[model samples]
Target chain A: MRTEAIDPPGISWHRVSPKYVTVRLVQWAIENLITVVVLTLPLVFVLLGWWRWPPLWLAITVPAVTLVLAVWRLLLIPRQVRAIGYAERDDDLLVRGGIFFQRTMTVPYGRMQYVDIGVGPVERGLGLCTLKLHTASPGTNASIPGLPAAEGARLREQLAARGEARLAGL
Target chain B: MTANVPEAGAPSAVPVAPDGEWLRVHPASPFVRGWVALAAIGFFFGRDFFERLLQGRPVFEQDFAGRAPWLVAGGGIVLVVTVLGFILTWYFTKYQISEGYVRVNSGFLFRQQRQARLDRVQAIDIVQPLLARIFGLAELKFEVADAGESAVKLAYLRMDVARQLRATILARAAGMVPDPARPQEAAPEAPEHPVLSVPPSRLIGSLLLSEQSFFVVVGGIASVILSAVTENRGFFFYLIPAVLGLAASYWGSFNKGYNFTAAISPDGIRLRYGLLDTQAQTLPPGRVQALKVAQSPLWRIFGWYRIQVNVAGYGAAGSNGETASRTTLLPVGKLPEVMSMLALVLPDPGTPEPGRIFAAGLSGLDSDGGFVTTPLRARFLAPLGWRRNGFATTDSALLIRSGRWWRELVVVPHQRTQSMALHQGPLARRFRVADLVLHTTAGPVSPRLTQAGLDEARSLFDAQSARARLARKRQISEQWLATVVPAPVVAPVVTPVVVPTQTPLPQQSPQQEGPQRG
Candidate 1:
């Protein structure tokens, strides 16, 4: 495989930090764990004889099935990380990522509603921060999962300045 | 400002002006206010019941022990809550005018910050509920485009302030200054169209003669009787006051309906109704996306029609904000006037053009467009009411179609269309006919003009979709052209530079020399 490097001047770039990626993964795990526990509560009750128990073999089968599903997701995490990438064009920030299907989304600095930068405990431990770009559309939320704290702050400042300039028609 | 104004016959001539005079909105309570009122009432009533219970009083005791103490405590609590409510209502509510927006900030705990851009605001509706009317207060409602879920409500504002804000917002939205030249003109005055006002007697007669109200009274009576029979024998005692209250309310509503008048103005439409809590909503025409003129079976007897519009940012029914329905252009239910009002509020569907075509070939006289096609292979598939389904379209994109046998009439304009859909059921597949529906951004005005012929409908659908897309593209392109400046062209001048000429002339071939000379 061969790769060529292109130097583009006056173009800005942003990257997600490792710490931010770790924080998001932890949050995702916590949320999925809650869902899993809620879904399995009935089976747990059945096994304890508090409710009607399924056949002994079926009872064993259900947990095994759930474990397989959980393990499948755990194995897909690396693929998910590899999918996430960012590129800055002349006028917009492009974030591209999807596990099974690849998608690239562009948010023009002029149209950005706001930028939020925050660091979770996990991200803080890893010395990384997350940057979220919000638009008027409530559902279409975009985020750069991880970036170094210093880089995140610098990107926030640059985005805010660009947004101000656009608003002022400068 | 003068410099920004376009010269005569200029292509882009719309003038952009500075922000208009600022107006202050009325201070109103948040949704939490109603919850607080309910909580206070519940607490007072609950505390009394609990006090009686603690004294070992029977649940059904007519004369309970410790009643006086409980009553005193309840009264004191009510008084305190009322005082607190009054202070909070006065102090915590405030709205203001920012550069190009109306900012409303309210609430004690969960703060709500709502802002509506002056330019985006389509209309201002003022609603006065029964309680607010007594205090000469009104709620100001703003209808804005692209406002999403934030419907602005200014609660308990002075009526004058609401009107002032409405005028200011309208002026700013229409891209004008608050011209001092129009000082004599009242801000909320209705237009003096010949059909604007219905005679007071006729209005009263219509309300009294309405069978709908009669049925409502009958329904209320039936419900009261049913409840009395099912709940308890002792409930009979309460029936007297309840019946009297019902009668009084019926009379009040009737009287309210009597003096009603609807009018269309150049700026917007105004409706005035109600006996106790009178309401006036000024709905600007440009804000209206869709207009619906409806008549019930009973209303048909009296040649009456009720008109409603689909507007954004107006509070929904039973919402915390000012009731938007009150701003209805015509509540008097006069058919001709309703039609004229609709024309004034909605965009023109354009004059009917010749060479108009029907997509659904032909079905029957009763079919929307008058034709139905059945292929030889698909004879088993036929619409149950083929006679009542079809669609027609004009070159300019006005579409009309009808179905449902009992209720019909759907018309739409192509410019407003957002999507086109085709559906096929198993039965439809057997007949080689499918349903084509065209959807628009406007609510209710979106017409599902089901053209019956599958192939023809698909072709027409493709054409209409392409037309709508082209119209949108043209609009965007026009805006872009107006804003973007083209780079100036520089003519290349061949200046005689001895060294440059010597180098270039030596390298040029015969073709190159000819082109350079030309």
Candidate 2:
């Protein structure tokens, strides 16, 4: 899963689980399920002949556009998931993501205050978790997603230990 | 623990002993603190009088003889209760200056006591608000290296006492032990060398030509034209608020920037400014986290520049004039003055030719002056500033320059860099260019170097990371330990930081030494 196009040499990069694509698709489906339900309400009312001033075609436009957007996002999810990756260097950690807007952030071990691991229902079901690194500067938002649960735990322990050892007490 | 209480009417005359003796602030502290309440009371009574006069009901003329007694009695009660509250607050609040910390034991019911460590001192500001100035008193604020909130605030101290206390506290924070034998001479005040002073004319001119003023003018004109075109008088109402707000903001900047002067002393860079409510700020060594030099398109005509800095303990500069003043280095300065202030803060620019490289960072372009600019192929991403936008490195600091019209230069020392980022958007990927951002503490100067070549970005990513690590490991703690550790004759040289790569980017190597500022 090493992307030859983006990964620099000398450091081993770790890609998130491919199953994350499914987790994200499920999460997206759950989030947009509400929009689809709400948008369908009006359409249902019109179909049932319950007082509707708007035309049937006008009502159809709303759900149609929503479905199109949902489909577009569904199509993009896999590549976006593939783009997510994190790397650990000697004295710092690097996290990069985003398809159109690629960003790589480096958080030095000394500046890290603590390490956090997050797991959602879908991620838990897929045996995946997210690892977040906190630094003194609030802007140091370095988080890695779709990490395997075991790998996430290991990385958290390793990062916490490294942070304590190199803590500059910032 | 037991402090001698001065009479509620009499002023406290204790000197800054630093002998672990608790001392009460000026007795008038409470009155000064209660000014808001007094103003509210004045408004209430004055409103009644004004309303009666407006109604032609004769406030003090017709019923004065009968109502005088009741009015006097009610006023007396209010005055008595207010004085009682003041006395209660005054009796409890006390502060102590010891060896390693300054403590304020205050609060009425909760009995709150807060202390700020001497070593953790970030900056000391002596503020004289209009009322305090009239009363010949000042407020001493001790900014500790905590979250931007001021740790210790000693309000309404006699002006002379506040100055002496500040000098004593700063000396202790610097780890200088006062010669106890001479109680009269507590670490003799450090001599100040005047560096630069901004003239009133220049300050006014800068204000008139500032970006805010430009926006205000544009907004005012647009609103006026709209009102005329639409023939709606309602549009005129918006002008009242906008003009009032603009007037208030202009006055704030004027009050804060008037007679701005910067000086160098052993303590740090001392800045004294403000017209009505004067402020003297002392930023000790290592307190400044970053620096930025900027120019507006309009200011280029007069060659005026602005320099601002970030310190750990100061809150972010906002609409408040005091906070804005805290971050400002030179409200309005010429190039030489700006350069001098920069030299003082960084001290070692880590270059054989500091002036030339700085000049390049300010205005040089086309990869001249050791700056690695964006490749020509990527000019499509930023056609206006592709030539001007670039980054450079001296031994101790990273210099980033950008903006074709409103030119800007940011300097972040390797040691002060909190973190860094490398990013490339889809557009940039096409041209094989990326942006590098060096993050410092919370401040206005966001040191982002844009459109660096892809290869250069990759190399810089690894190299800058290594440099930041090495720099942090070597930087000495800001806490001066003069009492224990002898001052080094020469300041320790940080790791010799360069671009690290031997082969410079194509045009960067052939760049000339001196700046060709447009």
* Number of the top lDDT candidate: 2
Q: lDDT for every model?
A: 0.52, 0.79
Question: Model 2: per-residue lDDT, tens digit, A103-164?
Answer: 88899988887788999988999999988887655567788999999999999999988887
Q: What DockQ does each listed candidate score?
A: 0.03, 0.53
What TM-score number comes out for model 1?
Answer: 0.51
The B-chain TM-score of model 1 reads 0.60
- Candidate 1 per-residue lDDT, tens place, A1-170, comes to 11101111232444354344466568768866776676577678777888775766676666667667876777676566655556654445656555443333445554466899987788888888778986433322567776788888888898888766533110
Q: Where does model 2 exceed 4 Å of error?
A: A4-7, A16-30, A45-58, A78-82, A116-130, A145-157, B1-14, B46-78, B178-185, B219-238, B480-518
Q: Which run of 10 residues does model 1 chain B get worst, by summed lDDT?
A: B509-518
TM-score of each: 0.51, 0.85
Q: Mind giving the per-residue lDDT tens digits that candidate 2 earns over B1-518?
A: 11342223333433344355567777898888789988887776678888988999866777589987988788778878888888878766777776466877776666777777886788899999989999999999898755467898888788877877888888777766554455445555678899999999999999999999889889878888898899999878767877888899899999999999999988888999999999999987767778999999989989999999887677677665567788898998989998999988988788999898888888888787898989999998999999988988888988899988989999988877777788888888888899888777666677888999988888887788888888777654555545236554212212122112333322122221112111
Sort candidate 1 into its docking category.
incorrect
lDDT of 1 by residue, B93-202 (tens): 44555344676655555555566666566556776777677666777777664434435777756666566556656654544423334432323433434346656666
Interface RMSD of 2: 2.2
